[model samples]
Target: MIEILNPTLLARARETGALVADILDTLRSRCAAGTNLLDIDRWAKALIVEAGAVSCYVDYAPSFGRGPFGHYICTGVNDAVLHGRPYDYTLADGDLLTLDLAVSKDGVAADAAISFLVGDARDAESVALIETTERALAAGIAAARPGARVGDISHAIGTVLGEAGYAINTDFGGHGIGSTMHQDPHVPNAGRPGRGYTLRPGLLLALEPWVMADTAQLVTDADGWTLRSATGCRTAHSEHTIAITDDGAEILTLPRRAREL
Candidate 1:
């Protein structure tokens, strides 16, 4: 369902967005060499509960997934990308980690993801992968404004990823988000400009740009949730929840004191 937030609901959306961003930022800071994935999940749960918010993923059970997702957050590492279920694993230096989080506060939901290297070891390939996704996410947000079509945002994102020599995957991309975790107006990572649903004020969209190093194909891990690159190469994902406005898009999910998008 597509939801256009009213003024009051929009306010709640901003709050939820800030909360989600803050939680992701906190998780990022806590993650490092020797960190356990389950510990990350526990920390996320505590933060969400302490804020009096609800985790959108904890009970999510879609047709594509095995069952209700029991984790508080998605913890993807290295080859793992989307829907990564937290497991027993200790992170090491230079491991690329992706944390995708969605939560609701005051009945409004916001979603975002960030991919970064754990610890001080920043390998060239891993850094490039994370930076590319961040650039693509920024480009996508830039294209989102009143009267612009969803395809415009998709095209902008695709241009950045494609130019960086990464293949685009449309199987899973961004989507409308508000009142709930996911909604209508599916936003692909790549598409023609001027196609799909037109943007309007009050519309909230989660634009995520993710890519695998070598292949566009994905393979589901035995856990039936974590999606990994077919080539087992490194991957990266970046996302933000933005609201279409009269003049432009407002990135609600920017973390506190975060660099400008």
Candidate 2:
């Protein structure tokens, strides 16, 4: 279901977006060597409850995943990329971690994800992977606007990742988000420009650019949720929820502190 949020709901979306971003920022700050993935999930749950927000993931039951995610946040480590279910694993120094979150406030929802190193980042490859995903996400946002097509955004993101020498995966990508977490039109990480749904004002899109260092193939972990790189290569993912407006795309999921600045 595609939704074009009205102004009132859009306002709520911004609020939810801020909450998601702030929680992510706080989690990132708390992450360090010896931090357990399950602990991160607990922290996220606490923050979400304190904010009086509803988790979009905890009770989520999608066909692609096992029923009821039962986790507040996704914790992807190193080779793990998408749908990373939080588990009992201690983060080591230089471990690449990706945290993906979504929440609803006042009946409106927002989603976002970030990838960073656990401690002092010594792996050049990990740093580069994270940077490339960030750049790709920016490129995708830049291509979003009223009258622009979804493919344009996908193409822009693809150009950045392709140039960075990372393999793109289309099975899971960005999508329309509003009252619910995931909606249509599916926004792939790579696609041809001038194709797909045309953008319009009031449309909310979650643009995510993710890549694997070596291959595009993915293998699901035993948990029946976490998706990892088929070749055991490290991966990185970056995402943000944007609202299409007359001027351009307004990023809704930027941290409150960042928005203040």
Candidate 3:
């Protein structure tokens, strides 16, 4: 369903977006060498509950995933990319970790993700991969404006990834998000411009551009939720919830503070 937020709803969306961004910033800072994935999930849960918000993931049973995600956030480490279910994994130095989070506050939901390297070790390749996704995300957002089609955003995102030499996967991409977590208008990482859903004021979209280092194929882990690269190649993902405005797009999930390195 495509939900056009009224003034009141828009305010709630902003609040939810800020909350998601803050939580991600906190989690990214806390993650480091020897950090446990479960601990991060716990921290997210505490913060969400404390803020009187709800988790869009918990108890969510989609056809593609195992029932009841049962986790507060998604932790994609190294090869893992999307729908990464938190497990007993402990982060290692130089490990590329991606955290994707969505929360509902005041009945509005906002989603966002960030990819970062853990600990003191910053591998050049890993840094490049992370930066590429971030740049692609920015390009996608820049293309989102009133009267623009979803394809415009997709094309902008794909250009950045393709130029960076990363393999793109369309099996899963961005989508409309609002009162619900996943809604209509599937925004692919790559596509032709001037096609698909047309942008309108009040529309909210989550544009995510993710890529694997050397493969477009994905393999589901035994857990049935974590999506990993077919060749075990390192991957990166970046995302944010944006609102279509009369003049342009407003990024609702942007971080308010710089996360500690």
Question: Relative to the true structure, how large is the alpha-carbon lDDT of every model?
Answer: 0.94, 0.94, 0.93
- Candidate 1 has its poorest 10 consecutive residues by lDDT at 252-261
Clashes, model 1: 0
lDDT of 3 by residue, 75-119 (tens): 999999999999999999999999999999888999999999898
- Indicate whether candidate 2 or candidate 3 has the larger TM-score: 2
Give all TM-scores, in the order shown: 0.98, 0.99, 0.97
Best by TM-score: 2
TM-score, candidate 1, is 0.98
* Model 2 segments more than 4 A misplaced: none
| Candidate 1 lDDT over residue span 1-261, tens digit each | 898988899988988999999999999999989999999999999999999999999999999999999999999999999999999999999999999999999899999999999988878888899999999999999999999999999999999999999999999999999988889999999999999998999999999999999999999998889999999999999999999988899999988767444
Count of residue pairs whose backbone atoms collide, per candidate: 0, 0, 0
Spell out the clash pairs found in candidate 3. Answer: none
The residue ranges of model 1 lying beyond 4 angstroms of the native Cα positions read 259-261
Least well predicted 10-residue stretch by lDDT in candidate 3: 252-261
Query: Candidate 2's residue-wise lDDT over 1-261, tens digit each?
Result: 899988898898889999999999999999999999999999999999999999999999999887889999999999999999999899999899999999998998899999999888678899899999999999999999989899999999999999998878899999999989999999999999999999999999999999999999999998889999999999999999999999999999999899988
For residue 203, what is the lDDT in candidate 2? 95
